[model samples]
Target: MDPQVTLGERERRTWAAFVTMRRDLEGALARDLARDGLSVSDFEVLARLDQAPGGEMRARDLAAAIGWDKARLSKHVTRMVARGLVERREAAEDGRGQVVVLTTGARQVTAAAVPNHVAAVRRHFFDLIEPDELDVLDRVLTRINARAVEG
Candidate 1:
């Protein structure tokens, strides 16, 4: 291992804490979304579709946006389509490409779930951190994400 690469005691502790926090946060959100008959993945897909232009995005683009592989996205989209949450359409500009479009039902489900999800996030995560801490945390996470993508 590189001499400067090994984690020190503080770094180890910080990494462990961050991992635990993220796991617990995701668990909480998953539970909240499950109560509404949706998984975290489902919520994410719907949310992304809702935000896209015309509430639709090419299947490949959606996969890229969510960092999921094509096969994984296809499976998720298949399930969502069965649940009446979304529909697949042939991309107008690309004969071979398909798009996933959010259904009205999906829009309604997301509209309802988002407020509750936000409240849960505020209660479980944001409320525990001070405003200054939040700012620092955001900056740190942003830099970490940037470095990760660069690497």
Candidate 2:
């Protein structure tokens, strides 16, 4: 193997561990949310909307925040709307654009879900990492997120 072209054995092992840990964490969280009638995607959308200014955000912004494509977000919003979890209103500034507003029901769901979600996060994520390692992880992830946004 070319030394310059290949990952060292330790690097390869570390990457594998990271990937497996991420997948397992996501799977466990998804299962926990499922019990509350939410998938990971649903939780993500709700969480974003809940935090938006005035509990509302542009549909495009919501899509960007959740990393969903326009069409996929449209479908998800439609379903959420039907369930009384969200509502769409024509943008006052731009008639062609739409805003998604979290309904009272949605806020209620998030208020209930957040505590449980945080507990799940604590159990499945934070508890597994030491405090010092968390600082390192945060710095690494923030750098990666910045790069992704720039890209």
Candidate 3:
């Protein structure tokens, strides 16, 4: 580990602004998802599955796609299964492994909720930014993500 270094005033302000914006954005999106009877995590998982081929993926793949650990994914899958939104079945190639499949109910709910989520994102974030500004934001985030992944 390297020695701790304090951020300068400008850096501190930038960090604060980044944190605030991320929190606000996530909170607003979560609220919008809630209105459609889905949590943010649920929508994230369902949306990914909805796009996947055959509307199904392995448990590990689903976890990775959604950036969740095994335990968290297991818990959420359990809940979703109980709600009839998804089902876990033995993997066709490897019976020991499990595959997650989106139920018809999940597909229906996700299809309905996507528009609301997109609208909320636009209203709370994108609509406020100019196209040029969005380009800059995309560049900035790509740079940051690359650095984080490298580290």
Native-to-model Cα distance after best TM-score fit, residue 25 in candidate 1, in Å: 0.7
Ranking by lDDT: 1, 3, 2
Candidate 1 deviant stretches above 4 angstroms: 1-5
True-structure lDDT of candidate 3: 0.92
Count backbone clashes in candidate 2.
Answer: 0
* TM-scores, one per candidate: 0.94, 0.91, 0.94
Over 15-129, each residue of candidate 3 has an lDDT whose tens digit, in order, gives: 9998999998999899889999999989988999999998999999999988899899999999999999999999999687799999999889988999898899889998999
- Candidate 2 per-residue lDDT, tens place, 117-142, comes to 99999999999899889999999999
* Candidate 1 lDDT, 1-151, residue by residue in tens: 8859799889999999999999999999999998888999999899899889999999999999999999999999999999999999999995888999999999999999999989988999999999989989899989999999998
lDDT of 2 at 24: 95
lDDT of each: 0.94, 0.91, 0.92
Q: What is the lDDT of candidate 2?
A: 0.91
